[model samples]
Target: MSNIIGFNNAIFWTDDTEILYCEFSNTDPNAKLESTKAKLYIKAITTLCKGKAMPFVIDLTETCGTFTTSVAKFIVRNSELKKLRISESFIIGTTGVKLLITLYKKFYDPATPFRIFADQNLAQAYSLETKQKYHNSIKKVVEDYK
Candidate 1:
């Protein structure tokens, strides 16, 4: 079984494998990432994580555009989110995104552990292994996009 939640531009879900998954699309390449949108997305993810430590896999292969430094900082420094997330995060993306993540890692200290991958299957496998190691099985509350 699986649970899905999303907006028009992104989606968050989980399958029986017990990994939290996120995918992005329909993003404006020219637009800066809005803080409100970022917060909303985090709220959705927080709900899915159910305050339990779990592995996360984010598919950024189709995501376009850039977010503000403040948004990135919030994601990396937020104490509440840090507490909710456990295990390593796997990000699936292009070389550019991987470089961005590398730069972010170089400049700022993140609260959660993460790695970037070009292959989704590899990311999934990594997350699955993490989930198994953590023995996490948090149930997600899925909602339809309005």
Candidate 2:
């Protein structure tokens, strides 16, 4: 697990899935969310996968942070983002939250697949399916080489 920039949260990584789990609690209302850690985590996955599929499953079940313009752009530019499974636990119909959701939906292309899950278990199951596909591809490549 990698700590957030401000040590407010910790990102948990797993070889079973590309999901980044951040467990946060009682964060400041107006505090700025540092995404550098998230960026670094994504970079790590990209490096490990080496251009292969790296779908993201963000279990944001306990944190609240406005997705700034820079983060939005980052999400758009990450080509390996096959799926984004976000947990909609704290986010309600607030103005800022709505705006962020609208921006993501507007900017994200239809070809890019994404979904919001209510719990981590469902998200993990979906991630497993994606991992299986990736594993199959690797197996095929190895067999071809043989």
lDDT winner: 1
> Candidate 2, which segments miss by more than 4 Å at Cα?
1-7, 17-26, 34-38, 47-52, 79-103, 133-146
Q: Cα lDDT of all candidates, in order?
A: 0.72, 0.51
Q: Per-residue lDDT of 27-137 in model 1, one digit per residue for the tens?
A: 566766788988888888888777776677877778767778998788778776777565455464567667766777666655456777877888878777766655533
Error of 1 at 109 (Å): 4.1
Predicted structure with the largest TM-score when compared to the true one: 1
List the lowest-lDDT window of 10 residues for candidate 2.
Answer: 84-93
Kindly state the number of residue pairs that clash in model 2: 0
Would you estimate the TM-scores of all the predictions?
A: 0.79, 0.56
Q: Candidate 1, 5: how far from true, in Å? A: 1.3
lDDT of 2 by residue, 1-146 (tens): 33232234634343534444434443455654446855765665555444545455554445556546676667566656443332222222245544555567667543444455656676667666665676787799999999
Prediction 2 TM-score vs. true? 0.56
Name the regions of candidate 1 deviating beyond 4 angstroms.
Answer: 88-93, 109-111, 134-146
